[model samples]
Target chain A: MELVVFSLLNGVLYGLLLFMLSSGLTLIFSMMGVLNFAHASLFMLGAYLAYQIGRYTGFWPGLVLAPLIVGLLGAAIERWGLRTVHRFGHVAELLFTFGLALLIEEVVQLIWGRAPVPYTVPSSLDFAAFTLFGTTYPAYKVFMVLISIGMFGLLGLVLTKTRIGLIIQAALTHPDMVAALGHNVPRVFMLVFGVGSALAGLAGVIGGFALVTSPTMARTLGPIVFVVIVVGGLGSLTGAFVASLLIGIVQTFAVAIDFSLIDLLARFGVTVTRADTFYDLWRIKLAQLAPVLPYFMLVLMLIMRPRGLMGTRET
Target chain B: MPIIRRALLGVALTLAALPAAAQDSIKIGYIDPLSGAFANVGELGVHHFQFAMDRINAKGGVLGKKLELVPLDSKANPQDTQIALKKVIDDGIRFVLQGNGSNVAHAIVDTLSKHNEREPAKAVLFLNYAAVDPALTNDKCSFWHFRFDADADMKMEALTNYMAKQQGIKKVYLINQDYSFGKAVAAAAQAMMKQKRADVQIVGDELHPLGKVQDFSPYVAKIKASGADSVITGNWGNDLSLLVKAAKDAGLNVDWYTYYAGGLSTPAAIGQAGKDRVKQITEWHSNVEAAALDEELDAYKKKYNEDFYFLRTRNLMEMLVKAFEQAKSADPVKVGIALEGMKHQTPTGEVYMRADNHQLIQPLFVSTMSAGMKRDVENTGLGFKTDGRIEAKDTETPTTCKMKRPSA
Candidate 1:
């Protein structure tokens, strides 16, 4: 009972964190038809920047300032870097982002060195928020959930109800027409890209302490973020949200399961021994493969639906 | 035409100086991950080696020649280790040092075993300082390899013996990184615990991907549900720090028996939460009852501005130099023979190289993490306090290594 309840809570929290990053990615993909390979790198930069700023002015100031800095940097990249390569088609933009990711990683290493920094949860929220079934849920985790949900609500409001959000949505489908009507389509793209990056940066500030802030942070979480967006759907925010929650919950619960194929087979009359041909493969538990579960879901979703859980567009 | 001539001249000069460079100092190639995920660990090993080399080189040198270190990045992968081995052999280095991963050590031993037989004159000696997989000194032991650290079985034997004496430990959980070393640690812990304390129930056994896990709360939750009073884990680096941090956050109160909890950054990461609860088994720690070693460690920290871990490196280097002096030659074959059944006195006690397996038999210390220690790890104001010590004779486990020595 504790396993079920805690797994549900932890999984939901993890899913919310993934949504924070993937929503921005989905938004950027909708605005520009390019997959930003450097999205996670920007998230890593946000963590490092927050760690730096937090060293002086405490965690709260760093929380606000780091995302703003990252957002501006994202806007600058879109203006000076991506806009110049816009005419070269999507492949060129993809390659440019790929190179940018590598460059960012190297620059981070040069600046921070190759060690896990001491980016810890702030002392203010370091205590247990509450205990459920004798297991303490950290107050920091509660803060993370609140922040992610708040951002999601605000993002949804601006996108659906605001005039700029209307222009951005119209620009996504008919950019040429939006520009014909005197709307600054390029500026809209830049705004969307900047906002998307800022969202990722916000995720990093909290996720950094939740996980670890290291040189390899980008590389480790890069694939999972991509999985979240791709399995959520290419450019669908709703799809991203559902996919993040599904993957997060599934992966977390899977870690609690110690059953293997051998166990399932043994429930029947079948018995497998060490001398079996693929004993190693047969003996692997779902718990052991929790880290790889996200990628496995990605492959299954691609083969089965391709358009993702709630995606409208097939692409 | 000028550029081409200059390039040719550079190549010829490099080729001309290569042999002369080899003659000036006996170079021991240090092969480990100096880049990628395990760079910090690899770099730490390098610092230890460099410090040891400097100390040895200060004493009028070995065989009248200063020992030079040749660092080659292996990226902590077996395939990359093989590549580094090739580079070591090609560069005419007859001694190589490696440690971080047991899989990498396996690769080195396999490559050098073949290379030693195929080219006896250029055979390289493998000095392993840390990779403690029991298989290295057992079924997979090589004539070219010498392990300085205690094997997994020996440490587990010592650790479980200590745990058995503590009447409080009724239930134990085994969690380790999913790799050769981690598996060896788990197997040894289980086997030894059963032998020592048959009444103790093994509550949980889990293996997770090495260096990939970011959150260990789920694993901690399972341990909590299992009602384990203690956890024995072989996870190192970020995995170790993150696991302890997660457990502390969740208020999961269980004694942690770890192999690498005292490693770089772990003490700082765990902070005050780990005080008096975390224990580690190692050959030496900062707070051990050895005044000379404490002075040397203090000096090392002062010089490098980093905590001086890896006392095994000092032993390895000193033994290597002793072998070089006793043999009076740089040839790996002669040194290998000299190193067999060799004895050296450490600050704590005397250690010997077992001729049967080339595994070092050293005294192992079981220490508990405590606050208000004279020496702390990673500046956490918490350090290891020695609980008990297992002598070299007690640490002995029978080896299956039928080492095939080269014909004299």
Candidate 2:
């Protein structure tokens, strides 16, 4: 019972963090038809920038400024870099972003010197929020969950109720029609890309302290973000949301299970010894394979349902 | 006519002395992760080696020649280490130093063993400073390879000995990174604890993906639910730091017995939360009460702006110089023979290279994190306080090495 409750809470928390990153990638992909491969690298930049700013102005100010700086940088990249590469086709754009990711990683290493920066949770939110079944959930985590939910609601309200959001949505499906209706379609693309990158930057500010702030941070979390988007559907924000939560919860709960193929086979009277071929494979517990489970699901999803859980269109 | 003759003789003498001056320095090839994810650790190892060499060179040099370090980037990969070894051999360096990962060490040992057998005259000796897998000294031991740091099993033997004496440690949980070294640590912890404190219950044993788990709350929640009094983990780097941070954030107040709680950025990451609760067993720490060594350590920090963590490098260099002096030769074969079963004295205690397996038998100290000490790591203001010290002989476990010696 304790495992179930905590796993759900932790899973939701992890899912929200993933959603924070995937939401921007989903927005940019839907709008530009170009997958921003440097999205995670932007997230990493936000964390490093926050750490640098936090060293001077404290966490609260750094949180506000870091994402703003990253968003502006992203906007500049869209205006100067991506706009220039637009005529070169999708592959060129992809290669450009891929090269940008490597550049960002190297530059980060150059500045931070390849060690995990000591970016920690603020002392204000470092206390326990509540105690359930003898385990005290931290206030920082609760803050993170609240922040994620608030962002999700704000994003939803913007996309549905606001004028600019409507224009952005229109630009996603019919940029020519939106342009014909006297809207600056190119400017709208820049705005969406900027906002998307800002969302990733925002995620990094909270996520960095929650995990670690290192040079390899982007590389480690990069593939998983793609997994979330792919499983959620290529160009679906709602799909990304559901997929993020599903992957998060599923991965969390998997860690609680110690069952292996060997354990399951023993119940059916099939004993496997150490000398048996692939004994190592049989003995590996679900918990040990939890990190790889998302990728495994990605492969399965590609095979079974390419459109993803709630994806409106096929990739 | 006499002036011209004298000038020609002077030119001949100058030409004759050039090669002797060129041979005045002995180069030792350093292969480790000088790039990639573990570059910091690899660089740190190089810093320690260079510092050791610099100090030795200051003291009239080793075997009448200054020790030169040739650092080659291994990237902490086995294949890259093999390439680095080949490059070192090609450069005519006879001594190789590396110690970040056991997998890389295994590759170096295997490749060097083949290279040494095929090219006996150009055989290179491997001096390991930190890679501490027990298999290196046991079943897979090599005569050419000498490890300065204590192996995982030996450290566990010392750690469990200290834990067994504590009455509060009843229900222990074991969490480690899922890899060969982690498995070895877990196995050693379990076996040693069972032998020492049979009544202590192992409430949980878990192995998570190494360096991959960003969140450790689920694992901590499990520990909290299990009502464990303490945790034994073989996790290092971010894995160890994140686990400790998560445990603190979740308000899980269990004692941590870790292998690397004091490594690199971990002290800063855990901060004051691990005060008096987290314990680590190592060959040496900063605040080991050796006055002379402490001054030397401070000098090292002043020079490099980094903590002197790898004390084994000091022992390795000192002992190697001793062997070189004793052998009266620069030949690796002679040095290898002289190093076997050789004893050396340091400020900490006496240590010896066990001839059966080229493993250094050194005293291991188990220390706890404390705040406001004379010396601190990573400038965190929190430092390690000695909890218990297991003598060199007491930490010794019988090895299974069947070493093949070269013909005398």
TM-score of each: 0.95, 0.96
Question: Candidate 1 lDDT, tens digit per residue, A61-145?
Answer: 9999998999999999999999999899889999999999999999998998777777888999899999888788889889988
DockQ of 2: 0.71
Q: Best DockQ goes to which candidate?
A: 2
In the range B206-249, model 1's lDDT, one tens digit per residue, is 99998777778888889999999999998877788888888988
Candidate 2 lDDT tens digits, B29-144: 99999887888889888899999999999988977899999999998899888889889999889999999999999999999888899999999999998888888889989889
Give candidate 2's error at residue B129 in angstroms.
0.8
List of clashing residue pairs for candidate 2: none
Please state the CAPRI-style docking class of candidate 2. medium
